[model samples]
Target: MNLSFTTKRLNVIEIDASSSMVEHHQLTIALPTILTPAVVANLPGYFQGIDSIAAAEKWLANMLNECRLLMLQSQQQEVVGLLFIYTEKHDAHIGYLLAEEYWGQGLAFELLQGFINLVGASSQWHKLIAGVDESNTPSIKLLKKLAFDERASKENGMLFFQLDLRKYPLEEGTI
Candidate 1:
């Protein structure tokens, strides 16, 4: 997989144990901002007590071992959010979160759209899946806007969504 890519307003880079300390430090500091109470409430069992560099590093290590983790950086080079993808067969399950301060700015749409364009054009993944908490209305709307069809909801209050890449229509001026 490509470790680094760019969108119109952000730089997306894969981050793992081998990533620079500076990048990890930036992410550690940005954790609180990105995973605010509202965000945390939406994401269950994903992040907890990750307030320090040590905790963040450990968390990253554990996560990278199972998923492909990407750091979302703004044009100014500040850590703004993260995107993680877990692949199974021909499907890629993705999750993303942006700093509270960056909310309502269309960044999420841009980020996801750019990602779809990239993966749709270059990867063999047959589909993309996303599971959002039932209470995360904004994310539900965002997924729908991206043409992801709603699948069955899990008993754990998570609503599943999917986008079949073969049937995804390319946007004008996009790959």
Candidate 2:
């Protein structure tokens, strides 16, 4: 999807691909330093704590050089999820782990919908793709709801789902 100007229909806020994943979930799709030292220190538990924050930060920063990161942030500026765009290939990858406190709500849909709108406008991208583990039904359901076609099987250790950004416009309608 091609990154373009944002049009918010709900509480969502839209920003450019240059933004960080720091606000992609519940936040306004904007970039903000909401990850405090404590959150950063403990977030490794969320990421399996296999790497240090410094290493992660370096990794994230390096990722920024090759991709665009969009985050979902809450009203209180708490980042709830993340979206990553590999600009060159026009592929989008998401990694969202909502806090246990906010499960069962449709927040992921809201976040992805806006992203679809924003990304679909891009002429740079012929397609947008997401990969999910077969066991991740919630994410698969969300992707299917968005109308991304699933490939025959898994690839690179994950199930691949793709949308022809030129054909399946996110603004077309609700699934």
lDDT of 2 by residue, 1-175 (tens): 3333232322333334444465322243212233434223323333333244454454455545655655445666555545566644555554444544455688767767776676666556777777776777788899998888898877646788888778645444554
Error of 1 at 141 (Å): 0.7
Identify the candidate with maximal lDDT: 1
Error of 2 at 26 (Å): 14
Top TM-score hit: 1
Residues 112-159 of candidate 1 have per-residue lDDT tens digits of: 988988888678899999999888889999999988989966758899
What TM-score does candidate 2 reach? 0.65
